[model samples]
Target chain A: MSEPAGMIHWEAQDSIGILTLDAPRGNFLSDPEFIAPEQLKDLLDQDGAKALVICGAGKHFSGGARLDDLFKLAANPVHLAERMNKGKSLLDFIENLDIPVIAVINGICFGGGLEIALACHIRICSEKALFAFPECNHSLMPGMGGTIRLPGKISWASSLETILGGDMLNAQEALNMKIVDEVLPQEAGMEKALLLAKKMTKDRPRKVIRYILQALRNYKSMPLAEAMKEETRMFCELAYEEMERRKNENLL
Target chain B: MKTSFKTLSVTYDDGLVHLEINQPPSNRMNSLFFNELSSLVDELCKKDGISAIVISGKGRHFSSGADLDDLLQKAVHPEKELSSSGTFSFFERNHFSFLYFEELNIPVISAIRGVCLGSAMELALFSHFRFCSEDAVMGLPESTFNLIPGIGGTSHLIKLAGLAKGLELVLHGEMFSAADALQYGIVDKILPRKEVVPFALEFAKKISVNYYKEKKTLYLNSAA
Candidate 1:
């Protein structure tokens, strides 16, 4: 589909949805050019959409938030807060999607771009992919939940140093830190992601897939007692369904 | 020191808790085995005398994983056997046992030999350190049976290894050797089958010493 200049583009491929970040200015996320929370939610809500693969349009995943836009927003504290909240909401939506989301990273994936990747369920990056939280270098911090998510992926010490030191991490380092899932050659990155998406979504019922994802999230977010209670309920439900199917097949 | 358990043997010696999976040839974990493990873990947690724990298996394999025959029988009428609270749910009880093992203050190491598959490997994941025999085979094969690891295998594996490796292991259900497990950062050390337990015990002793030293230092600092 055709899009206006500097607008995010997305299209459906079978059961997979690909969301591309394309901006005229080096794919640097700015308030005016970035994909909105509503647009992302709408894309995910599409009929028969089982998975999504997010990637950058050009050489860089993103150089991160534009400094000029930051400066302008800095002048208006209220506007900056609003924009930050919106960005957080967008990332939150991506993270909580029922279907799996894969971030196919190539070239630069720093700051806000890296935040987007972090929000995805799985991340596959090119061997040459570069990651960093250079917000500290600009006397700012990641506003879209990077600080919260980074510690969960890597050691708190490493996260602290990476965010506070404003240093770039190579793809191998990212893999070691458990930040990115797999590191492939730049040419093979997107292909691997699609293969994974196809493998995860193929032949899996939507209800089963939704249950698996929801249970995992509940285990993470809810108290142990409540999560275990729900897990037991789901397990019994699935087991009952399986038993029913077996009995029906026996009759045939 | 509890010398006798139906499927397991426990011996407490000089602050080191030696627990062994004693079922023959292929130590198939069953509901009874799990029940014993949970009770043992609860007792182990309460004792201040314990410094470290080294868990291993007797005879050929560490474990063949869950006894599928037993599991199937129970799952068929889970309300009668596997029920917790209302009826039907394996998640209610043994989870706390695994969590307690993972959350232990002192070091816990698993000395793995031969096969450590399915829930057995998941148990090893709960340990702070895992030392396996060079010829040991390890994997999570739940997907082969059209099931997921009901316990914390998925979560713990993803936490220890990366998300990709976790997905690959769980989805493909491929068995990896000890060397591969080491390369993948699953197990810490690989030893000869005969030396696996000795190595684990030695490592445990070292960790126990270090733990006490750290505790002493903390105490001194707080007093000062």
Candidate 2:
């Protein structure tokens, strides 16, 4: 079954949740609060998905947030703040998901669209993909977590230049800067993304995947000693479960 | 100033301090190497007029990493040798010694050539910048020996490369080429074998004055 929430179309394929940006042509984001964070969370929880892939419906991934819509929202300060907060929260939830989230990007991915891509755990883009943070040209910075996440993904110098210079980057340049993991042919992005998703999650139990992802996430948030302790605890738990499973099998 | 060392050779030119691993023919870091490193770092910490530091190997290779025989002996014997404080273990003391390079205010550059593995790679990872020769072979091979990188290699690898690639490299314990190392973000640049040290020295001289004030990429892109 497929469901549409705002501009996003959510569907499940072989236990992989696929979220497609459904706006045709440019896929211009008309609103910051396009999908409610709670609504998306509920969908993910009920889907029993092992992995998630985010892509656009048509040629372009996204032309980014519509400047006209943003200008209109800026007039009402309270409304704009609320909507931006919702958008930020949505990205945050996606980043913190235990299941791996892959962004299969094609063509243009700029501004807010780039921010959405940054939230994913892995990014695979087409050779024709072009990226930029054009907010600087519009006399504004990225309102969503772009300022924080881009540096974490790439070098601080490169991220600063990318955001402030407002220059367009080809897929090769982006790859060179370590912004995206891999770049395939124009039409091979989705296929590669699915294969990668399957390779990472196929036959892997949900609990094991969750534990591994949680440990990896903890490395970023906690101190080295604390994270190592957490890893040791998780390792012991998995070992104990394995021992019990082996014992039961032997008895049978 | 003391001019000689058992495991390391220290030389100064203007404001740049050149620290070379003296044990030649695949300089394997033994206990003496770690002790010498700790004292050298302490000396550099106390000395003045040190604008930048460059580390390299004496002969063909940077290092073959920690001597496994020495490491295994210490592991099996479970030595009671603790730090002066009597609280920290031998591993923790060595970890802190490696970490001191990263904490230095000046830019620390590594000129790597030929093989650099295990704890040697970990030391390069802690440097501000690493310039490798085309033939440089690097990896953390402790996993193959039923061990893991003890002195912050795993964490630093993850920081340089992402979590997925880092975990894969450590688990597989495979040697990667200089090109692959550059792709993994482990090394900043790859140059010819002879140019590696000269370029690193030139780079250190060029950026030492405004290291913290200016962007690193600017100097990296500038001609050496």
Candidate 3:
């Protein structure tokens, strides 16, 4: 009922919730506007929220974590570890969400920005978008779950090149690597994300949508036999739910 | 190593082995196909001369995957399914056999063309690299028939393609193009139909030689 907290600007239109990273130029992640765990969880938990789209307010998705913040954390090792864990936890929460989460990338997406996009369920990018783990240039690695998630999106060899080389990937190159699901002309990234979200959730009830998303998460981590059995169980459960819903509607 | 098999033909060239699925009319995996495949891989594991292994199909297809008729028959007689875990299991020792490609330190390249579906797709997923012809078709079509991928197709695909797209590919049960396969990280390269084998060989040789050189360097560096 109340607006979600944090620097994220949350608004619902046509049953889709959009979270704009409302920060200054480059949308540096360490800015005060960064979405906290509680804030994000609150936004996603809202009722009637069919799908969520995360995007930047200005030219860049993010310049990634701030250098000043990194320097400050380096001076306090314990605080640094806790901050790293929190970032990882946020990505994990986004990944395990029971509804679709899409990242609409524009302009510069570097380091933590790229990690955030990778953690989402799907990624869409603008033609002018540039992606890289500039962390290597800063003499650090992507500590916010990028290294483990990168290999799953692209080839292991290419993942190394992207992370270690600190090279930039244009939109087409990202598409070739399958790092992003779709690449649209500049400024069309948000429209494409909305269309895809709409198509995915079309004619499906909230429960069915959630079930599909939850069941999919199992395929990634569960054993083959276990995942198969879980899939069958979900199928049968959905079947029963559909039957029950039909019966109730007829009775009404 | 014994070279004769009813379902496959093995040819050794220099340090590379070309293993072909020879069943006519789309090499379908039946009982004999599994037996031959299991024995061939086991033997190849012991052979010292091989530097890389290349797998392809004899006819138009890399494989049409499991024979539905054979699978149905076995399903009807579930008691025949072997089990080492004290449970009725279809993929008992066969699970290990399918995963053997990954266990090999040497490179395993799947030169895929035509239809690579069902269990065949699972087999390709275990290969270190997959090279396909432009006209190649690939997918895991089991979910369409009310069954899930039995032999690690779900996990391997999720590893190659991200979790969301991987689930969509299997859940939708749609066959895709070699280009789509490459985009999904399922195949490493797409070449002309006539060139798939040659490209696979070249890739295998390059990686195999580089692997040995890297190993020697690591050894020397560690010793120093």
Best by lDDT: 2
Candidates' lDDT values, in order? 0.77, 0.80, 0.75
Which model scores highest in DockQ?
Answer: 1
DockQ scores for all predicted structures: 0.21, 0.06, 0.07
Q: Tens digit of lDDT per residue, candidate 2, span A81-135?
A: 9788878888988888887888999999999999999998888899999999999
Global CA lDDT computed for model 1: 0.77
Candidate 2 has which clashing residue pairs, if any? none
Per-candidate TM-scores read 0.82, 0.63, 0.63
Interface CA root-mean-square deviation for model 2:
8.9
Off by over 4 Å in 2: A1-52, A62-83, A96-101, A108-111, A130-143, A146-182, A194-252, B1-36, B47-52, B58-60, B64-92, B105-107, B140-175, B182-191, B194-223
* Local accuracy of candidate 1 as per-residue lDDT tens digits, B1-224: 54357988887889998888878888888988888987887677667778888989988788988776565444544444443532254545666777777777787889999999988998898887788999999998765555656667666676666666766665556799999898878887788899999878877776676564225335323322
- Which clashing pairs does model 3 show? none
- Which candidate, 1 or 2, would have the higher lDDT against the true structure? 2
Summing lDDT over every window of 10 consecutive residues in candidate 2 chain A, give the lowest-scoring window: A235-244
Error of 2 at B121 (Å): 2.0
Task: Give TM-scores of chain A for all candidates.
Answer: 0.92, 0.95, 0.92
Stretches of model 3 off by over 4 angstroms after superposition: A1-6, A9-52, A57-87, A96-100, A107-115, A130-182, A194-252, B1-18, B30-32, B43-52, B67-88, B142-148, B154-173, B180-185, B188-224
Tens digit of lDDT per residue, candidate 3, span A106-141? 999988889888988888899999999988887899
